[model samples]
Target: MSTGDGVDEVAEFAALLTELKERTDRSYGSLARRLGMNTSTLHRYCAGEAVPQDFAPVERLAEFSGATPEERLELHRRWLRAVAVRQAARPRTATTTEPEAAVAEAVLPEAAVARTAEPEAPPAEAGRADAAEAAGADSGGEVGSGGGPARRWYRRRRTALLAAVTCALLATLGTLSALPADRSPSASSPWPSSSADTSGSAPARTTAPAAPRPSPTASPNRSSSPSPTPGGDSPTPRTPEPSTSGGTAPGDATVPLTWTADSQAWALGCGHDYVVAQPPARVPPPPAAQDAGPWAAAQGAVHGRETVVEITVQGRSTTAVVLTALRVRVTGRTDPAPGNVYAMDQGCGGSISPRHFAVDLDRDRPIARPVAGNDTGTPIPAVRMPYRVSSTDPEVLLVTARTQGCDCSWYLELDWSSEGRTGTVRVDDHGRPFRTRSIAGLPRYMYDTSARRWTPYQ
Candidate 1:
């Protein structure tokens, strides 16, 4: 069947599968080994020459290849369409037994009347009739005399019965053809719905149970807590957590800790600064704190001086995940981006007390050190690692990575343990490393809100 795009459903599904496989950068043999399937079988599925009886294998392959949630849902829909097409193309056979029985029932009464009319016959005639019956049985024909009025009547009746049966079969076929083609799965279908758990290891079943609905009262992954201001006794502004859902399950090989990183979170003081390749005249006015990421991208900007990233981590299945440590891996170091310095704001004076860590990117081997908030009057104590996070209780970490000597491209590695399993999850700006360029000697500028124009920083 077509998938509304003129391409066959099976071919579309195969194309998506092949794309995911290629994105992983893993060889077919290695991926097959991890999936516990033959290499040739996977090749056939990706080649559009075959489809799997179960979707579990496909799901596992998708997860291993790092498909997003939306992609996975679309893949499931395509699989359903392909399965429907295959089922419809199968040949169907009709049985003739029921129609033949109906014909027999209709002819029984007439045959009895004919027999009554024909009373006792001569011995020779009876013997001849018996021989005719034997010959008819051997040839699988009607049970009647060889050539007489009765035999002719029987032939006419048989012809009418055959004609009636043929008409009925035609009518049935027409009715079937008039009905709409339904691609949806039937009540008895073995495949699961799109909402089924996508943990990459769900077993195939005849019927999928309803997925558990998320609770209305469930707390968000990022929650705000009160922290002290830089100087005054008043409470500080609540640092908003990154908006994200619960963690995803990474199969049985590692801990089921789900996390997300937001690099655009409030960077207090000069933390929101960025170095754009454009000049002051070409740059747009500074945007709100939340719009910093996109604004910087539009101006072709890179993080300046330091980049403060907010990471929210949660556990799946109500199990607690212990965050052991945060490690920094610097991929490259070079001279800072050559451009004008732009500050997101004149100044953001607030102390952040969320599990804060600091990384000096200029060091050969940078380490994440737990650092206190930037409060001068009273230093907020630093929260240490090994924090427990569950579905009901999630934790947020604010990592401030700074560089003074070089422009650094780096990413974070989070080591976690839960339920006797331990593994590491890499955190970066999507698939690329987070970049922070040193702004040691550049002039800082900010948009003057009162004047509605860009001005040099005081």
Candidate 2:
């Protein structure tokens, strides 16, 4: 593959895998027979001549080698990187034309064209011909034309434009490279988690027993050269510690909220992208709002950004964990309050379970609430909901609800202000309610508990 660096990342991983296999002292024939595949296929994969699209075999090999949890994680990360390199090397198009050819055909002068018209031309002459054609095109004159001074001027301008565009394209690519690449929750690991996630959280660290040191006889099949341990330099993602929660008054107690998810979820914002995972590490709570003038002070709500975890449950029991972060805020509260807000969505049966918690810093306790719809006499469970505390306005917490098993759902306006001062109101959902949006400019509507009718939302 013609990666500019000319490094065969796939081969590197293959070598690493080879080292691991040798440590197990299992011959290719024995391994292949166990995996029920051709021996050459395994060799090809180990030799870096080919990569396995499905990772089952690789995972199995890791298991056979008795790789430790960290080592296994490293192996997976390396495999992913190798796959990425291989895919990137694949040609995107069946055919491509040289840019010079197009320029030459479009702008070459007749004399120059005739001289370079041979079926084949030397590299040096071809280069000169391309330059001459580019010069001709810059003049803004027909291929056969002559605008001596004008052509020179145009050529200079054209060259400048090309240089500027090249710079711009390079800059854009660099920025894109800085962005976190998206990977499905199932692809990286089975679980999802976040510390303060808004979208899917990043992969969490896994622990496994370390493999025993191979015997001297087992070392014979391995190459003499040392193999680099994968992800050795990378920081291992740590499980977030559980946050503490419990108080009622501003300084009486501070409670930390507990967040859980049956599967992985995503949280994207604040320049950090992640997937939710479990046993999350604690993060700093949101800082209190700055004291500006009275108007500025009342302008936006103070928000907390922290890492959180997501747990994958099987019939009420957690099976795996992932980690991510989230941004939470409480409206109409800004005086360095000892609490933070957290929200979670979990898969419950055929629908979704929505929950949000407020951690009281002073008392160290959490206040949990399940946000549901009361459309029918009985509450209809929601499948998913999008919500957020207002930034500029300190009194609005916007949320929209949607049901999973059925088509029943609506919008809710929550007053996530101070304790003893918060409230919730059901409003017309504008039909499609799964989407999260602000109700600030929406048509005035509110649920009339007594009349049970939509009325102006004063």
Candidate 3:
């Protein structure tokens, strides 16, 4: 659009045409049909038999073919250059002896100057122009043009290992020139792409940008509407995509909402803030992270000291054993579950003892069948393991585990859903393990327990 751009859209248009033919394997007739134009028109353009008067169709077609805004602009500039050359080419004009030839010599590089010099242009120019216009088009790229953007990005991400290995080493090796947004010498005729990409490869043109055009086959109103390309007119995002392994907010319907018990919900990062799906959606009070004793535990039966557990074997064959203990009882009760009653203190509670427990399934199977360990009342932290059985309603239960490194209490809230049931365990809650992290292997794990040993289930 600027005067300094030199050539006009014609040259850029030519580049777009060439790029299209190369990028797609479609035959000429097929391409014409897609453009809603007659094959002969396409042939004339391809064969240099005729020049387009409107230029809209050619530009639009380029857009539909996924050409970028920069490319489109270059095509426009090249077109202008081509027209100026033609005017200069008028035979024996009063002042100009050969305008077209002169303009051609000025715009075209030394290599191509003599080759394309003529009163009439050739088809190959258009083809080459189209491809050249999109020098850095790639399907998955988010940036393009000069290397400024990429270089700045490298500076910011210098600490990132991937950035260092991908940019630093590549540049020192002289392979960086070919990396991201680099402009080729031949691309001077058109405005060079912006300097945003840094992948050390020309940023691939993303999806075609929006344009102002109407297709012959479509209604006038609809066809004439503008189309914008993906990342064409907008700035690229600075941050990397967040890790998929993290937890999602409650509103994500895709995620099974596992509501924590109001009393134990605080341990789930509820605090004073309403985080849990108390009313389901809208905004509910966050579950309380217990600050005092049993009443303020991370995750366990509200009043009782046991809970349910649904276990899914990871890499090895293992079973989830629900060990119950009565924490309120004076002494601890270490008893295995019959169906689902769990406890931490068998002798400590009213009629039971304060306790801790652990369990594992038969060693033969790597992953045990989906089983539900129902209410082994009050699954206390440091006393048992936590595992999930199903992901359907987003259930949560407390299970205990004995790790190789140490014995700690933590909670597990089913981040994802599968054929297995969901569960939550208390980590470092109350008299449990001293450390305070749960969702360990899950990365988002929050550890909340202290020094407490969970014996492996026999």
Which regions of candidate 1 fall more than 4 Å away from where they truly are?
1-254, 269-271, 351-355, 374-379
Writing each residue's lDDT as its tens digit, candidate 1 over 1-458 gives: 23343238788888888877765444577679878899999999999888887888988776555454556666766775566455435543465354544433333333234434654555766676677777777888866444643455555665776688567646644543443211233354233445665367533211111323434553222222111112222233222122111222212112355566777665563347878777778888877766666676677778888888888777653555667888999999988756778877665655544447999999999999997653445555575666656665566788999999798999888877654446677777755688888888888888888887778888
- CA lDDT scores, all candidates in order: 0.64, 0.35, 0.32
- With candidate 2 superimposed using the best TM-score fit, by how many Å does residue 399's alpha carbon deviate from the native? 72
User: Which of candidates 1 and 2 is the stronger one according to lDDT?
Assistant: 1
Model 1's number of clashes is 1
Alpha carbon RMSD to native, model 2: 27.0
What is candidate 1's CA lDDT for residue 439?
A: 88
lDDT of candidate model 2 versus the reference: 0.35
What ranking emerges by TM-score with the best candidate at the front? 1, 3, 2
| Local error of candidate 1 at residue 15 (angstroms) | 64
Candidate 1, residue 244: lDDT: 17
Off by over 4 Å in 3: 1-16, 87-192, 197-458
Clashing pairs in 1: 247-258
TM-score of 3: 0.23
